[model samples]
Target: MMIRFSKMQGAGNDFVVIDAIGQAIDVEQVDWRQVADRHFGVGADQVLVVQRPQDPGNDFRYRIFNADGAEVEQCGNGARCFVRFVHEQGLSAKRKIAVETLAGLIEPELLDDGMVMVNMGRPDFHTRDLGFVDWQQARARGQADIDDGIERIQLASPAPEYLPSLELDLMSMGNPHAVLFLDAPPNDDLVEHLGPFICTHPIFPKQVNVGFAYLASPNQLQLRVFERGAGETLACGTGACAAAVLALARNKAREGLQVQARGGNLWVEWAGGQSPVMMTGPAHTVFEGLIVLPTR
Candidate 1:
């Protein structure tokens, strides 16, 4: 079967967005990995399938699949692209849209400036929320601590003597994340070496996205992320949010922070405790076409 899809990007993260709502798609029969393959098919960091909302209260529902074909809970960049996609496709006329994801409800609004802003729900620092294990032992070893209701932990570096141990703030933004604040920008080699190590760490049962962040100033952050299934990408929306929220909580940065990813820039805002994080960024349409679903 052939499917119509839009090639979209937010910041630098790219996606193959399929309008499942308008097409009869047998999602199970499609080879997601093939569609996301850089060389063999439509290359993308993830595939976004837009469908009609399962709940009456929501305007739409969407699912995210990584390049490796694993379905994930949340995706901030894709959310922006989602809103743009629906509007361009004539699926929705409202400037603000309420969508359902595996993570939960998220609201995305289109601004007059042509940028999209997403309400990424409250950040959760509970270990249980992140499915983090060995909490008791980590705390006993003085590698973990709680300050201002936020959990911070120290992870031994793989190259201890040569590299400094990483102090990470763990949180769940619908998905798990480990943010490491660094004194300077991290090199590609360092991110390549350490990102997977922390992402697949045994402590994170469901795995985690690892963000290496440098606070450029009180309101500017530079970041790189190794995503759980997609490896490294040009940008990661949720990673940006995770980094900004953690920085705000720790007083390392103030609200309305600008996060610079390799691909582009995203603006994040938070009102301290229990408030939803707002992420603003641009979503672009690269192209659109039809591709046949692989039977095997």
Candidate 2:
């Protein structure tokens, strides 16, 4: 079978988007790991399968699979690319459309400047949802609040190369993330060295995306994220949203913040607590191609 696909990128977080809605493809039967392979298949941070919405009011159903073939709850960058993909393909005429995801309905809008704005939904700060033990103490003494917060936690490190009991600000932006605020500028070495430990830490039972964030200014921040299954990509949309919420909660950043990732910059705005985080970035189509799949 020849599967048609579109290669898209939002802030350098790329995806191989397949139009299952139009093609009538049974996406569940497809081997995503083989399709996401960089050397042997279409390379991407994740694979997006666009299908008709289950709900009558929604425009589409967005399904996400990481490079490792695990289906995740949500993806901000992919959401942007999703809207762009549908619009370019004439799937929907509306500039602003709602798409259903594992986390819930996410609305993404296509702006006049060719940028995509997504309402990433409200972030969850409660420790229970974030897989943390104590909500009150963890929030109060989060690493953002104390200098030696990393030493406060008694959790053992998952690896010997990493430090034990690293303090992190946990949150759920459709997906779980552990934000580690750093005093100095972040580097690739740090993300590569400490990211794996933090990502697989026993604290996060479902695992977590580890974000290394640095407050550059009141409204500008630098971030690098090690995604759950994709490793460290050039950009991570949900990571930006999670980082923005954490930065604002810790008073490190203001409402409108620019999150500079390794690939590009994304604008994240939050109106404090219980409000959806707005993320604005660009999505581009790299190319389109067809892949031949074996009949299993």
Candidate 3:
């Protein structure tokens, strides 16, 4: 069957948007590897499927799947693209609309210039759930020490980061992440080089998003994350949340700070030291087209 989709971007983080409303398409049927095939399929950093709201008092419901087809919660870049897609396609008339995601319900406000700002709920944390074994195992496998009250998982990797030298903050916002603070902005080559290394590290049972942060001030930060399935994306919502939390812990930045990602800038805020984290950013529509589903 031929399915119509919209190709959109938020700060360079691209996605394939689909409307499953009144359609019998089983979104889960598209496997991770298949959806990420650039030659045989619609290529994108992630895939977003629009559907009827699962909750009352919401404008719509949408789900995010990484290029590898792993369903995740809350994509900052994708969220921005989502609202723009809906507006462009005449799905909603309101500029401010409430939508539900795997992470939770969020309100996205569309700007006049076509940028989107979303109220990404908060950051989540769990040392164990982020898929790390105990401290000793991570130290041995990842070649790092787990001090400073930060819980971590050190999944094995073919070539891992210098764990002992780097400080990583672990968290989840419906997905898992590991954030590292760097002295300077890593070159694009360095980012591409180490991102996958940390993502596949032995300590993270579920390959984790690896974020490298450059702290500019107590109120400003620049970050780039190698998303688990998507590789080094322009921006990452969960990674931003984790970076904000980690920055606060190290006193590098305060809550309600500005974070610059590869895609663009995001405003991240934290209330309680260990409470939910907030992420805000933009979304844009690039074009719309049709894709024929490949038979399995």
Candidate 4:
């Protein structure tokens, strides 16, 4: 069968958007790895499938699959592309669209500036569900004594050359994240080298997305994320939100922060954990095409 999909990108995080509302397609059964292959298939950081909302109040259901074929709970950058794809395809008429995700219900609004803004729910600070383990405390007080929420802890890389211990702030933005503050810009060599180690660190039982962030200004941040399944992408929306929220928690900056990634920039504003993190960024439709399903 030929599957029609739209290639869309939000802040350089690209996805192949498929509308499965009326189709007989079993999204879960599709070969995500092939679909996200850079040379053999339609390369993208993730795949977004649109379906009828399971929740009556929502307009649609959003599902995300990583390039490695794992279905994740949420994707902030893909969420923005989702709204843009649906709106452009006439699937939804409203500028503000409510979507049901594995994490929960989220709202994405199409802004007048041709950018999509997403209500990224609230940051999860008190839950160990995101796989933030305090190895320091675990070693001293035993694993049973460790608790949840953000804490500064020393994390040693598995690499022999990079033996320096790093201090990272662990948090979740509908997904797991490990944030490392840097004194200088996140260059390609440093980020690509240490990102995977931090992602698969023993502390994060479910693995994690590693964000190398620097405070560019009072209201701006420079960030580069080594995504768990997708490696180093040009941008990561949830990463941006997580980094900003971490900065906010430490009183490093106020609300309305700008995060600059390699591919582009994202605007993030948050009032704290009680309020949803708002992320605004550009979503562009690169092209549209049909892909024939490879026989298994």
Candidate 5:
């Protein structure tokens, strides 16, 4: 079967967006791995499936599939692209729309500059809130550490990296992320090397969105991320949020700042809002095409 799909992006994080609202397609049959496979399928950081909203009050139901074919809770960049896709397709005429994700309802606003700003809702900081714990400490003591630090609170678990522990900042901007700041942002090669290590590190329970960041300004940042389910991508929306929150906590950045992702630059500034932060960026529609998936 030829599944109609659209390619879209926000910053540089690209996606294979499927609008499954009007028709019924067996999602179970889709070999999503091949779709996200860079060598064989439609290469992308994440695959987004857009469905009609389950709640009449919402605009759409947003489903996310990582390159590994695992369905995740949320994706900020993907959500922006998803909204743009629907709007350009005439799915909704409303500028402000709500999308239901595994993480919950996320409000997206269509801006005049052709960018979409998302009210990623309130951020979740506790580690256990999203099912994660300290893995390195567990390995250290052969007993494991139960509490791993995320954004604000630490959840109990086993394992913390290093001698006694490693500080992991966990934040949920609709999606779960584990962030660790370095003296300076690691180089690309280092990011490629240690990124997978920390990503799969025994300390992270559900794995994590690994980030390497260096503060550029109180309102500016430079970063590279290895996303969970997806590998290194040009950008990550939730990843940006995680970094922004961490920057704020460390006083590295003020309430607002710009986070430079591998994909492009995202304007994020948060002082205090219904949502603590606001991510503003452009969502673009690339050329549409039919991609044949490999059976093997």
Candidate 6:
């Protein structure tokens, strides 16, 4: 079977977006790992499958698969690319549309400025929401603290001599993330070293994305994220939202903060409380192509 796909990117987080709505796609038949492999296939951080919404209230259904072929609940960067893909493919004409994801319904709109803005729903700070299970144990061991409904936990450092431990804020933006504030600028070495440890930490039963963030200013944040299944990419949209919301909740940064990722910049806005986080960023169509898939 042959499948048509678009190579798209949002803030440098690239994806191979397949329009399952336009063609017959037995998702199970495609080797997602091969599709996302850098050498063997159309390289991408993730594969996005666009299907007709199961719920009539939604315009479409967005499915995300990591490089490892694991289907995930949400992806912010991919969400932007998703909107652009549907329009470019003549699938939708509306500037704004409601899409159903495993996490929930998300609304993404194309702006006059050529950027995509997404309503990522309210952030969830409850440990259970992120599939984080070690909170109670950490609290009993005096390694965790809860204030204002946000939980902060201490994680032992990979190198105890240089840094005994690090504090991280755990939250879910439809996906799990651990945000670690850094005093200095984020370097590749630091992110590569500590990111994996936190991503696969035992505390998180389903694993988590790790974000190393530096507050450049009250409204400017520099970040690097090591994704759960894709390792570190050029950017992470949900990571930006997670980090920004955590900063806002802690009063470390104000709303409308600009998050600078390695790939590009994303703007995040939130009114706090139960308000949804709004993320604005660029999404581009790199190219389109057809690939053959094997029949079962």
Best-performing candidate as measured by TM-score: 6
Per-residue lDDT of 162 in model 3 = 41
Candidate 5 lDDT tens digits, 1-296: 56678888888898999878765666767788888888988888888998888999888999888999899998999988888888888899988898899888888889998879988877776555456656446455553323333343222323333212335566677666767665665577656766677677656767878877778778778888898888888888888888887787656788768888877888786664344667888899997887554443
Per-residue lDDT value at 52 in model 2: 87
Which pairs of residues collide in candidate 4? Answer: none
Q: Cα miss at 68, model 1 (Å)?
A: 0.7
Clashing residue pairs in candidate 2 (N, C-alpha, C atoms within 3 angstroms): none
lDDT of 2 by residue, 1-296 (tens): 77789999998999999998778677777778778889988899999999989998888999999998889999999999999999998899999999999999999999999899999898877546444434454446443333222112334445444344456776788888878787787776678778887777655566789888999999899999999989999999999998888888777789889999988999999987578899999999999999874322
Q: What stretches of model 6 exceed 4 Å from their correct place? A: 294-296
lDDT of each: 0.90, 0.84, 0.73, 0.84, 0.76, 0.90
Off by over 4 Å in 5: 134-166, 272-274, 291-296
- TM-score for candidate 2: 0.90
Question: What lDDT tens digits, residue by residue, belong to model 3 across residues 152-216?
Answer: 44333333454334446677666777776778776776577678877776556677788888888
Measured against the true structure, the TM-scores of the candidates, in listed sequence, are 0.95, 0.90, 0.84, 0.93, 0.87, 0.96
- State in Å the error of residue 130, model 2: 5.4
1-296 per-residue lDDT for model 4 (tens digits) = 88899999887899999999855677767888789989989999998999999878789999898998888988999999999889889998999999999989899999997888999999877545445564555457333322234655566565545436577777788888878888888877788779887787666767788999999887999999999889999999999999999998878887899999988999999997599999999999999999975432
Worst 10 residues of 3 by lDDT: 155-164
**Error in Å for residue 44 of model 6:** 0.5
> lDDT score of model 3?
0.73
Task: Score residue 17 of candidate 3 by CA lDDT.
Answer: 88
Query: Model 4: C-alpha RMSD to truth?
Result: 2.6
- lDDT of each residue in 1-296, candidate 1, tens digit only: 67889999998899999999889987777789899999999999999999989998889998999999889999999999999999999999999999999989999999999999999999888964455656766767788787688787788999664357987888888988889888889788789889998898876677789999999999899999999989999999999999999999888898899999999999999998889999999999999999996644
